[model samples]
Target: MKTAAIRALPASATVFPILFMISTVHLLNDSMQSTVTALFPVLRESQHLSYGQIGLIAFMMNITASFLQPLVGWFADKKPRPYILPIGVCFTLLGVVMLALAPSFAMILLSVTAIGVGSAVFHPESSRVAYLAAGSNRGLAQSIFQVGGNIGSSLGPVMTALIFIPLGQKGVLLFVIAAVAGIVLQTVVARWYAAVGAAPKPKKAVAHDEKSALKLSAGKVRMSVGILILLVFSKHVYLSSFTSFYSLYLIDDFGVGKQQAQWYLFAFLVASAAGTFIGGPLADRFGRRNIIWLSILGTAPFSIALPYADPFWSAVLCICAGFVLSSAFSIIVVYAQELLPGKIGLVSGLFFGLAFGLGGLGSALLGEIADHTSISTVMHICAYLPLLGIFTLLLPKDAELRGR
Candidate 1:
């Protein structure tokens, strides 16, 4: 876990620790949030929220998390990441517990805040460690680390289903388990790093000096930023239309129930993880830009072709789409980080936080569009966004233009 270039921790130490750290934080959130959202309609009926209110609540949570990300990234650059981690885990644990016990709007709002707080805290710090782990081969290191995100995502609906059903209140116990587990993991990581014999680097912002402050050169920085935003737009549309809503289409059009759709989604996500795991390392082996563009092109037609399929074909296309989508997640992350090597935390926040935050917005917008237009149209439109991204990729090769 030491930052040194020579004699880095073996893969056993480097990969697993980073993976566990990133995955655990996301695992906690994903496990709980899915349950909360799936049950949201039922909860909303019981709670008597207006559509606006529900939308506002989601917006509140996201905006709160989104706004705080840059500052968190800045702080992570200066602080010991693990030191702050326990607190974030505790916040998630608190939020989940409060959510389980919640009886009123105020309480639920408070719980959402807790969830947002925990989420904001984790992204930047976790990315820092993952980047650190990739000391020599940052791409592979990030691929291993990025697996945590895909695993957590796949588990979200599954765990949520379990928590809400068979496990009942006990399944809700993931909160306590997550909190306690985090404490243990933190202790182990701390000790592991200690044994490796390096004081954890302080996370102070890379901007301490003017040169490194915005070390990214103006031209490359602008291009990279624009590319990320374009990619973000496409990503958001895919997530909203495919990741979140495709199942709904299956259910509505094909009479697939929540469980079946969820299972399919899980399969899609697993395929995606496989893609990312393979893609990142592959990009390193081949070329980052080439792989990235290839994934975009490869996935676009498949995703666009989704609405035309019957159930069986849809699942196949969905899973194929997953591979293409997953491949980009880690690659883009490493792509962003290398572009701003010294600003790993900030870059991670931009890649993950902004991309996802905007994606969430895209999700919401799609939901609203679903109200006025057919879900079919939304899916169709979603299909083309990624295609547009292919044009954006041609702007300048990310590798050639990074960090100015």
Candidate 2:
């Protein structure tokens, strides 16, 4: 089955138009979804919600997306669904509308679940689209796709500060336009995919031999996959602390206003967006393992320093932490695709699912810790997570192992 799917596709010429189109839709879709997190402080004030409850809200949305994504990808891999993209954006549109009018916490959860479902549908298919459009430059293609989401994620806090915070939750309604735009854009992309998505043009004979040389035993492949999953776990757990609670941390520790804290979060995420672009081209040249190692582990010093720094230094360290860590994800995704050539959709889904799931669980658990102990303490504890990058030693070197 996998072999058939691989053979159906011919390698493509790098399709810049399709890549840019999908990335634009990604920016729109994620900007809507991330707007929820950006509004957390306001939601807490409006509802008198606890930190634990806030964490649960993130958990609810992410877990919903997490649980469904792998299944969606697995199904799509077996049967390509070119038109599913627009349908997913419709779910996001509905979710945004519901969130704007949400009367109670229960309604908010339901709204986020809709949003999550949309995300679950969106990521795998969109990633596969990036894969199809990549041609020979897979790493750069994934980075181009990913940077849009990072930039969108950064925009959430800014949007919240400028729009939602001022106009109240109803400001979320304006983003419905973005969702509608996404549906239109994705529909066009769907048509493109229907024409060319599965057809990878034949490579030159030497390239074919290189592909054959890259084969690995099932056991080694599985082990590499496990290592990648662990890397995801480490990355997201640390990030969950920031995305879910960094605003609160700034408020508690530095006496910053909520809006100000959001700006800081925006800065960190923007740095992340910058880092995402850098990682891909570097990995394309230097080796994915080297970039992965540096991205996951190299941030440890800054992560450790962030908790103790004064407000200015804290923001600076956070930016450094975000930039260094952010590079790993695109590297990880493209590397995994290289690892399992035919299972692009399934691999994308699984890794993206694990990222959401682990981040959700980490948020939930860390929120409880903050409720009982202190946000400062939680930050101190999470700083140790990137040290797990020591395990990157376990990943097989693709260049070295290609012909073994």
Q: Which prediction has the highest TM-score against the true structure? A: 2
TM-scores, each model vs. reference: 0.83, 0.94
Per-residue CA lDDT of model 2 for 1-404, tens digit only, reads 23235335546557777788889998999899997888788898888888898898889889988998988888877777989999999999999999999989999989999999999999999999998888778788888999988998899779868987798888899998999899999998888887776444346744754575367777887888898898999899998999989889999888999889999999999999999989988988988998999999999999988999999998899999999999999889988877776677898898888998999899899999999999998899999889888778788885844454
Off by over 4 Å in 1: 1-21, 40-58, 79-81, 104-109, 165-171, 190-217, 395-404
The residue-by-residue lDDT of candidate 1 on 1-404, one tens digit each, is: 54353236554344555455655656555555444444443354568864335544554455566777777887666654566666766777887788777778787778767777777777676667666656557678777767766776676556534545444433555557766776566555444433342344435523332334255557856776678667766765586465556666676678886667777777787887788789877987887777777777678888878888888998898899888876776777777666665666787766667755775576667767766776677777787776755754644464354423
lDDT scores in order: 0.65, 0.87
Supply candidate 2's per-residue lDDT for 9: 53
Position 181, candidate 1: lDDT: 75
lDDT for 63 in candidate 1 is 57
